[model samples]
Target: MITLIAGGTGSVKIARGLSKTVDDLIVIPNIADNIWLHGLYICPDIDTITYGLAGVLDKGRGWGVKDDTFVFMEQMKKLGQDHWFTIGDKDLALHLVRTNFLNEGKSLSWVTEWIRKKLSVSTTIMPASDDHIETRVETQSGDMHIQEYWVKNGAELDISNIMYKGIESAKVNAKAVEFIKNSELIIIAPGNPISSIGPIISLPAIRKELESKKDNVVAISPLIGNKAVSGPASKYMQIMGIESSPFGIASYYRDIASNLVISEFDNEYENRIRMLGIHIYKTNIVMEQSQDEIILSNYILNIVNKA
Candidate 1:
């Protein structure tokens, strides 16, 4: 099985494309984006991956259910609710079920797998941890949850610190550890390195386990031509005083990831990136179209298979 550590829509796009070409795919989703909003447990990354792999993702937005309506969010606003993070009616269904299950003492991992099966997704999707590990961003204004910084404030805050609240106590999901230990290859899908993927690796045991198999890990850079395709990754990187380029991405993953995949358009930086002692693969990393995603997925699989 090919185990993928993924978060955000970019990674979901990769999962969607890879599913068409590979079998026995297992996804470890980031739960830092999850929040308790409107008395519902909202898991953005997990839902994105599950919906994308299930062929029900909103292609235009790269997240949420296809053609989902936001009548529920509108109604919540009429009731004077803070509905800054819009959750569509259909999308809220999953949250309702998840909240109910959690209230009933079901684990996040169990709820996630239940949702995946309900979505009819073939891929085995798992959460990074079952604990309440929230990603808190300390901005110039003050500290706030990741969603508040990312969605409500439009990610315009000057980040002073990024911390995973409760991560120190969060244990790696048992199934996730098992999958990583047994998978033939491990892939870090393109997404925000700090906010999206950082929380997953922050779990000490998970990081240690992954570090033990660094030789089998390959990371795909989220940036293309020195800019992120979507989201506030570029801005976030800049705020952290890190270069928002392919080189910066390679540097961040230098220790855990043995190889990096960058866009063919970024081939000029291969030499500089390789100086970090990480192997580089330059190809079409942008997923603007399904065919593009498929080609890139197949290429990565071929590289791992040949190894």
Candidate 2:
């Protein structure tokens, strides 16, 4: 069993690859990325995993379903609706089904499992918590939804603060906790610390439980050559007033994590990371495309085997 803290495109691919090999793979996707637009819920991170595992993902876009139509949005535009966040035709079906299940008072975790089951995905996908963990980004203009800040607007504003709304009340899924307790390893994928992995680790209990079993814990650095592989991870860290380096990220997770797997490009900082008394596994971290993903996955599995 593997308890994985997952977020974004890279995390989904890593989780999908691991699911094929691990006996019981449990994913706690960051719910802080959840948002409601035009009165419907959208979970980018969660659905990215689902769509990828189900083999319906748009390979080119690296997210959403393949051959998915956007006629819904086209119609919305004709009706004078502002389609800021574009949801494809087939993808809309998922949102509708999930929102309906949630409206019936089912927990978000339960709804997520149902979605995976309907799609016949083998991986055990779960939300970070059943509660609404919305990410609110305070910018120079005002507070905005995470998707608006990242997708619609391209992080054009200076981020004043990044908050996880409802996280204090968020509760981890029971199965996720059990997976962590019974896992042989805890592998944190390369993801944005501020907006991706941070939200899931924000829950105190999760942090406590993980720290208790830190011997098998390992994290992949999202940075290569002091820049992010994708997204605003470097810029986001700077705005959040954190340095963009493998060592700095190590400092952030030092309390709960025991080791880091940095990219080959960051060899110069390995000495600095060693100063923190944590072991480092150096390799190529960026999954430029699908082949890079497969290779990185195998490399990490080898490290796990060695451990």
- In order, the Cα lDDT scores of the candidates are 0.87, 0.82
- For model 2, residues 1-307, the per-residue Cα lDDT tens digits are 7777888676877776677667677787877888887778889899988888788888778788999889999999999997878899899989998899889998888899999999988888877578888888998889988888887887788788898888887777666777777888888877788898998888877887888987678888888866887777787788788889888788877877787888887878888888887788888876666667677777777877887
Model 2 lDDT vs. the true structure? 0.82
Query: Model 1: what TM-score?
Result: 0.97
lDDT of 1 by residue, 1-307 (tens): 8999999787988888788888899999889988988888898998899989888889888788898999998898999989899888899888999999999999999998898888888899988799988889998899999999989998777788888899988877888988998988889999788889989988877787788988899999999867997777777787677789999998888878888898889977888888998889888887888898789889999888788
Q: What clash count goes with each model?
A: 0, 1
lDDT minimum window of 10 residues, candidate 2 = 285-294
**Runs in model 2 with CA error above 4 Å?**
none
For model 2, name the residue pairs that clash: 69-89
Which structure among the candidates has the greatest TM-score? Answer: 1
Where model 1 places Cα greater than 4 Å from the true spot, the runs are none
**How big is the positional error of residue 101 in model 1, measured in Å on the Cα after superposition?**
0.3
What TM-score, computed on C-alpha atoms, does each candidate reach?
0.97, 0.95
